[model samples]
Structures are given as C-alpha cells and as structure tokens.
Target: MRPNARFTDVQPIGLDAVAAAAGTDPDVLRLENLDTDVPPPPAAVAATTQALASGEGNSWLPLTGLPVLCEAVAGELRSRTGLDYDPSRQVVITSGGTSAVMPVLLATTEPGETVALTDPTYAGLLQRVRLSGARPHFLPLRVEGGHWRLDRDALTQVTTAAALLLMSPSMPSGVLLDRDDWAAVAETCARTGAYLIYDAAMERLVYDGHPRINPCQVEGLAERTITIGSVSKEYRMIGWRIGWIAGPVDLMDRIRMAVIYNTTVSSGFAQLGAAAALTDPSGSGVDEAAAEYQRRHDTVIDQLAGLPVVRAAGGWSCLVNATALGLTAPELSSRLLRYGRVAATPMTAWGGTIAPDYVRLVYSREPVERLSDLRYRFDTALTSG
Candidate 1:
C-alpha cells in the first residue's frame, strides 16, 4: 500500500526483476522462480493426450467446471479435511490459481474492507488484494528458534478483518501454520464472523514429516472456510493452469459468478488433465517432488550454514536475513548474480512486514547436485568486498 492514499505509486514485485536479470544464462544458478523441474504426473499427461485426441474438455458450456473435475476436487478435499463439499454447487474452476485468488478476494471482501494476510506473503496475492480495492492487514511471522512462526500476538488482529487470506507453507518465508496457530485463527474467525480464505496451492509440499491440518478440520471452521487450490505447485502442472475454488454452497454461488466474470472459465483439456491427476489412485507424484525439494532445501541451508538463512519447514523457498549480513536485499541479490552467478529474489514489496534486507532463494527449480556448491557461490559473492 502507499504511504498515503494520495500516493498512488505501486511497488514492483521482486520476482519479475530477478527473472529479467537472470535471463537465459545456462550457467547462472536459477533460484529466482517458484517453478519446479519435476514433470507432471504420468496419468495427467495421458489424460491430456486422450483429451486432445477425443476433445472431451474442448467445450465452453460448463463455465463452473467439468462435473468430473469438480467431483475430483471435492473428493480430494474430503480426504484431507474429512468434511464433505457438494461438487455441483461448491466448486468453480479458474485459468490458474493466481486467477482464482482475485475472484475469491472479490467474493469475500469489498472495497476498503480489511483483508488479514501474513507478512511476507506471495507478491501476487498481495497485489491482488490491492487490485480488489481492499486494505491489507498483515499478521507478521517471526523467525524464532531458527524456524518461522506466526507471531502469536498477530492472531489478535484477525478480529478486524472481513476475511483472512492465508497459505500454509507460505511462499517466500515458508512459514507453516500448525494446529494451535490454526485453532486460534479458526476460533477468531468464528467469533468475529470473518471468512477464512485458504490458498492451498502447495498444501502437500511439506517437509520433515510435518503434520498439515486443514482449517476445515478445526471445529466450526468448515462452513466458513473457502479453499483455493491448483495443479501448479503440487501437481507440477503450471502450464496446464487449472485451479478450483470450493466453499459453502451459498458463498460458492457468488464465488462462481466472480470467477465466471473475471476469467470466463479455465481451459477444458487442462481441467480434464487436472481431474485425471486428482483421481489417480496411484497418486500425483507430490510426495516424490517434495522429497526432491527437501534435498535441495537442505543443501542450500547446509551450504549457507554460517549465514543468516532461516530454515524453511515446508514450501519451495527460504529467506536470508540480508540486514544481518550487513547488506540490503537488492544489493545482496545483485552481488550474488554478478559474482556468484546465483539468481535470488529480493523481498521488497511482498508485504509491509518484510524488512529491507530480506532476500528469497528458491530451491524448487534447481537440482540438489547443482545447489551443493551454494557456500562457494555465497562466500565468493559476499566476500567480494
């Protein structure tokens, strides 16, 4: 947000800047994107192939979603939360998870309403809040005991929100909300009549045997919970760009209309592919992907052991405290790119709570072998004088 309403300038996202600077350099260790090199599930690929040949998902009639795909998402949620959502009236498809978020924001909040979100959240999500004309109230995450935690004090502020837009394994910081944290949020929402809008794109990408509890599982939260998920992060189907929004049937009507108005509908074949991935009893390969990502995460943290890197319990990236290292985030990022050939993003405008010296290093895109030399690169970069 601007310092004042009179100030209309908006901050540029750090990811795009790093991406443009990194370019197509084969030698530059590309740690600037949330992308994963892991391929999509075999079942999804096969289904997309079949859809292309037979044209099953080629229609524009059902803008909400394909009946099969909606059921698949409903079943997926049911398995995770043990709460049932009617596929027919509770799910709507979108061009992508990013696309789905805007409509959800639109549905849950109004112009000038407060939307509670974590500090250091996804830049895209923060931007969408501004686009939807809602004011953002950030609940800061603290790095305590070398791991990220939702500052228990921030939970009190949820009462002032029209909705709480959050993600477990939150991007950039990799802060995962545990059972107690979620219980507090659920209780607050129930007490204050605030909506719980969950961004579940990377819900399955946990590390080190951590337990992930859905907000729906927290007593009385199911009816107030709105989940937005996609195949992008967990399913490795970024190109497919398929996502869904599910919630109470009455709220779902407004959400469906918002999505329909905003994106018209998601791609037909991609929806079929996502359906196939979600329904495959064999699974969607998320566990294998998370394992690979954990290895990469470990290597980077290990290499930067003496540095100011915070451990990411889950998700694809972690933060480095540039201020503690005696440098601003952009300056550190520039040094890494120039001297170390490493592309890392500065967390400048992601949220108000991110300090001026925070830089994000993405581990999902690169292999562990390539990341083994992280220390050498960092030492070379930081000690360059």
Candidate 2:
C-alpha cells in the first residue's frame, strides 16, 4: 500500500541539515536553531522534579490537561488579552506548539478545504496544513519601507478559506502585524466565517516598544480565534514539549477529541513544569530572557549594516536578503558554513516560491559577544568571492 498523495509535494528542508554540516567544529557558531542559550527557570525544574518524585505524573492525565496547567493557561490568556476563559472547557494542552497546529487544522477544516497562510511562513505550519489534507493558499506579504506589510487585496481571498493561520512576530521576517492589520484580519475572519488560528509561541518577545496585538481583543474575533502558545521560547523549556490551545469551548471540545486520538495526552510532568512557568511569581526568568533577545536583535541589526536584511521587531530570527551575494539561499548557506563556520537556515526551508533570496539567522542561540564574531565571519565569507 502507498502513502497518502498529500505527502507527495511536501519536501521540507530544515535546520537539521545545517546542524549536521557544522558537526564537531569548535569554532562553528550555530545560528540555525531559535532555541535560547538560557537555562530553564529553577522553579520550573523543581516543579517537574516534584511531579516525578510524587509518582503522580506517571499515569495518563485528563486528555484536556492537568487542572493546574489548564488553569495557568487560562489565567495567562486573561492577563494578556483582557479576556477570561473557563479552564475546564476552553483550554487543552498539547505536546508542543508545533503539535497543536495539526489537530487544530484537523478539527476545524475538512479535506479539500483551503487554509490561508502568509507567504514565507514557518515550514512546519505548511507541512501541517498538507498533513491535514487541506489545500494551502498563500496571502502574500510584501516588504514595504523595511517592514513586512500584509497585502489587503490578497487578504480578501481569505474569505473563502476554511481557516487562516497567523504567526505574530512572524518567523524568518520577525514582523509583527500592527493594530490596523489585526483589525483588518478580525473583520475578514468575522465576515467570512473563517477560523483564525493565532500562533503565539513568541508573543512575549517583542522589541523596541512594539506592542503585541491579540486578535481576540478585536471585538468579534475572540470566539473564532484559537491561540496556541508554549513555554519553550520565553521560559527556555523547549524540551519539555508542553503547550496549550485556547479558544471557544465548543471548538475546544472538538480539539480535545483530536488530542485524545493523537498523543492521548501530553507529558503530565512537563505540564507541571509549564504550569510553574506561567505562575512564576517573580516573573524574572521570562522577562530577563525577552530583554536579552531584544539586545541580540539590536546587536545583529547593528552588525549587519549595509546588508539588505529586514529589521526584526520581535522573535529570535530575521531574514537576510542574499540576492546581492550572487548565490541562491542554499548555496550562500553552504559557503557560510564552509568558510565562516556559521550555520544559518536557508529561506528555502520556509517554503513558498517567493523566499529564494533570503536566509534566516537566529540570534537567540548564541551569546551577544559571539554576534560580533559572526558578523566578521559573514562579511569575510561574502566578500571573499
């Protein structure tokens, strides 16, 4: 028997290749993974240890989530979005932010229905749409005045879509949609009856006074929006693999069924760690990490002057336009790895035909001091040709 035809056109080139290429090189600076070098908060670790020691986390938890974890997610959402959700019905934990996408798509959209996503989106999201058997349509974003702007005309096409997936502080570009754009998105989703899936994995990482806009705050959009967030980015707990999806109770009921069928439930111990992260009274760990990321963002922008790189307002990555280097993204990536000993993700991995001219550099993985060395190496590598 053969596999589903939906897997045919879904070839993904990811950062694993870059990591493998940079293997065992002491001088090689890894700028490929968006993972932070920061340690997980002490409290989070303690919480996980406690859960494991108590033996309570050994068995399966409620498919929705442990009550403490679910309550923590709802509380965090209320604090951020000024909206309250019932923990018992409105939130369900998943294996990770990435894992949450597939079930959401499966629960919301039927096979052959279209799911609209921004061009040059996260490659994993694109794969998820394909896995869900939904047609992937793109709403092209244009670089205008050194920022990524959503094309209004292209957005109109979203009206026919079964769902619209959006990532704030978008991957590769690091562009956060402004309030007006959020308003437009809300209007479109409300008018068209399309579900708005907001990927908020990096929501707390904004920089330079750029405010994070929650579409759920936009009046009619709350009921239709599903927010997927994780402790991976801000809490430095990527390996814990705990995330939550928050939305209307009815829709979340369907998502819970999907979760039950998929992984049964996320790690019970990991959920305890995530709960501690969200309820951290000091709030120093996440805040300090976000500040450090902002500093790295500024440092990279400053070091890469005169390059056609887009400025990152938030998130761990920004796109460098490699067209002037007279090489495709993959070719430039190879040269950088060979000569500069720097590993970066090529834009080819981001999917879509419009991304060939760029490479994604992640600032979060390296120390701020290492960024200067990365800059010098990149400069030497590009100019040597």
Candidate 3:
C-alpha cells in the first residue's frame, strides 16, 4: 500500500498510532495545547458577540488584514517589543501562528534554500519547514542546569546562507533562550545574511521569574527578523484563529500576497476580537491564566526536580530523561497512559537527538492540584518499568 507522498513519511497523529506503538491505554489525557483554562476578556467577547448579534460576522476581510487590528497590533508591538512596525505595511494577521510561518517561508526562501531550526524544537515547525520544500538543519541544543544551550559553532556552520527559525521559550523543553544566546543567533544570522524567523508562540509562558526577551529587540536584527506571534497561548483564544506577523515591509508585502492567494481572509469579527486582545492583554482574561500556569510550573517543577529521574526546565513543561530508567519514552508514555492514566509526548517529535529516551510533560493545562497525582503516576511508570 503506497501512501500519498505528501504524507507517506509523516507520522500519524491519531490515537490509534499511540495504541499500536505503545501497547498502553490509547486514551490520552491531553494537556499539550498549553491553552489557558480561562475565558477571553469580557470586552473582547462582548465585541465579538455584538458583531455576531448584528449579523455582520460573515464577511471576507482584507488581504493585508483589518486596518483596526493591524493598528492595534502595531501599538502592542511598540509597547511590548519597542519596535516601530507600520501595521499597515508590516503586519499581516493570519489564521494562527501555524499560518504565519508558511507565508514567511514563501516570502523569504527560494526552493532548496535551507531553514535552520533549533533541535528539540517545536514539532509542528519541522512540518511547516518541510511543507515549504526547504531543508531543515537541526541545531542540537545542549541541556545545562535547568536550561537549553545553543552550540554557537554549530549554529554558525548551519546558518551560512540559510534561513533561521528560532523559538524562544521553546516547546517541550521550555528552555528560554537567554540574552547571550539571542546575541549569538542574531550575529550568526547577520553574518550569514539569513532571515531570522522568531517563533514567540510561548514567549509569554516563561516561568521562574524570567524576563521576556524579544529576539527582535536585539540591535540591527529587527530589519531582517520576521516575528510570528499568536493570541492562542497568551490570550486564551486558540479557537479565534487569529495570529499575526511583523517583518520588513517588502517581505511583509510578499507574505500578504501569499495569504491572499491561499486563504483569502480570516474571520473579520475574529480579527476584532484579536485586536481587543492585543490592546489590553494584562486586562484580558489571561492574567489569571498566567497566574495559574505559574502555579503549575512551580508545583510540577518542584516535585519533579527532586526526582532523580527528571530534570525540571523552565517553560510550561518538564523534560524527563526516560533512558535513565532503561525504558524508551514511547514505552513509558504508553505504560503511564494505561496504568497511571497519564500521557506525555515523545521528544523525538521535536527532533531531539535523544528523543527515544525522553518525554515532554506539559504542565500548563493541567490543574495545579492534580500535579501531585501526575508526579506519582510518573514515578510509578518510570520505576516499575
């Protein structure tokens, strides 16, 4: 049976794939979305509701995006990142962070041009890069005490003439890139003339009292940097299908072309909701959610950190080295699902070099009180096997 080439080699994402490989309970307790357990701001919801009630919610938006949302986005960027982005010229609202990546790829790279991404990165990023028909050069991240390290030499070598896709407070590992790492990456990209694509999806999810460092904040990199951000993680609006991109004007124009040609327009009313989110994030319904996630981070990391089997990394999750217990991550994940009623992602999904032996446990969506039970389950699964 020949599978369609487009998806032949891609790993299946269904539940059956979990059962077939792990021989554990197929039903997974999903906590991977990192979605806020809170609702959107009343102002945003009310605005959207009003738009819906008015019966004008069904309309195509502009290719360059809604002017109101774009201006709001510019204001937010100026406030948050201190970058003066012309919303009209530099911002394009898309379906989500997922949609934002493709257009950037379309705008920047020619076919066969390489994309350099960090290893143990966000899994979906690899798929997007591949979908764009570009080669992904994975730069392996060195895990130090509670953080992930970038190999500057490896980064420089791979980044020569390659587009760089970097995620801050990266997925799974949750290791936030510090100032020095950002500097090296910026310098490397500048030297190589590569486009720096910063995925700040989980930028706001940084824990342990770490300050948020926008990679675009680095000097001289803003002109060449393409920033993709989402309201999903920060504003509790994943269902809104509203995300945005900010970059150099010329590149942004090209991305708008790609967006218009493909999806045409995202929901007009949803853009309004997202605009509201951008304008008043602290006042948005996410402050409580961020507080909750912060609590979960503290609870999970403190519990898992003392365990010899796991090392706590900053972000929304903890990365456990499963090989230390003589079992692969998939095997342990399967067993945990069945016996412990838990589920975790195998790190290989993110191109981690030692993925088979490591699992990423997302803590954000889980209730803080249940973290104790999760820790116990993990202990049983890892030690028993």
Model 1 segments beyond 4 Å from truth?
A: 1-9
Tens digits of per-residue lDDT, candidate 3, 251-305, equal 8888889888867788888888788777874668555665677787777667676
In lDDT terms, how accurate is model 2? 0.84
TM-scores of the candidates are 0.96, 0.96, 0.90
- Tens-place lDDT per residue, model 1, 1-385, is 4365422434678778888998998989998898889999999999999999998878886988899999999999999899788899888888988889888888889788988888888888887888788888888888898898987677775667788899998898888899899888887787678899999988888999999778888887888999999999988999999999999988889999898888887888989999999999888898998898899999989999989999998889999998898888899999999999999989887888564568999988899889988899999999996
lDDT of 3 at 219: 77
The regions of model 2 sitting more than 4 angstroms off are: 1-3
Clashing residue pairs for model 1: none
Hey, what RMSD does candidate 1 come out at? 2.2
Candidate 3 regions off by >4 Å? 1-9, 12-29, 285-287, 306-314, 383-385
Candidate 3, after superposition: displacement of residue 118 in Å?
Answer: 1.1
Number of colliding residue pairs in each model:
0, 0, 0
**CA lDDT of 224 in candidate 2?**
89
